[model samples]
Target: MTRHPEVLWAQRSHKIYLTIALPDAKDVVIKCDPEGVFSFSATRADGESFKFDLELYGGILLEGSKINTGLRNIICSIKKENKVWWKRLLKSEGKPAPYIKVDWNKWCDESESDTHDSDDDYIRGNSEDNDSSEDDGLLYLPDLEKARRN
Candidate 1:
């Protein structure tokens, strides 16, 4: 059975950081549609294979996108086409997806980066700022009736 590699992602002002763990693969195949659809597939030397696809929130500048590898990890930096803020990395029809874990140690806050303001607080420890941000940090909306009963 081919297993998909674990993926971790984060987004900054103008670009998104995606890291995929490709244990034994030295090469990978990636495809991106001009409309912000992205897919990556790779087969490792040991026969492990991975494939993942998703739609991005905003269009990307494919020409400026870069993919690199480090310690069996395939890292991709995708540049946003419009240089605008994406409330969510990918578009969702209903409730937004769970907030992604940002690699803070590896990522620097780009204050000068014009894509967005530093208004999001996905961290669980800080609940005071949750209401102010567009995303509530809850994967799904709370039940209004349940809250009222409580």
Candidate 2:
């Protein structure tokens, strides 16, 4: 029921970019805590499932963190509220979240609209591929709604 997919993340001067490699995941779900915790889960057609939780390097602008889904991956573009890069990709206390390598083209631009907004404590999205952005072999921004209210 719970598994950790391959995750890749990087930081530019102003943003933290993260991607999870998961093929055949339907009904993908993602969540973020205002304090920088990130989590997600997905199921395959055959019922295989995956989920992972990682503490981001620092706090993020919940209004600016976003999810982009592709045919085989999911990417989150997060903005640092403090506008500074962390010494590492996650919290300073523990072992960092597992990391993977990402291609340079995965870096996105600022002009794209933000698709994530946490009206509550959690948010949700899917891994569908009918989107035009997926057709471009790039990721499609997924609109997210808060998944919880406490």
TM-score each candidate: 0.63, 0.64
Across 1-150, the per-residue lDDT of candidate 1 in tens digits comes to 555676667666767767676776755888887789988888888766767787888888887576655456676767788766577667766553333345543354456444233323321111343344332111233559999999
lDDT of 2 by residue, 33-150 (tens): 7788888889876888988787777887877566776667776777777865467776767675455454344433333213222211122333355332222122434345543432
Q: For candidate 1, what is the TM-score?
A: 0.63
Give the least accurate 10-residue stretch of model 1, judged by summed lDDT: 117-126
Clash pairs for candidate 1: none
Candidate with the greatest lDDT versus the true structure: 2
Cand. 2 Cα-lDDT: 0.62
Candidate number achieving the greatest TM-score relative to the actual structure: 2
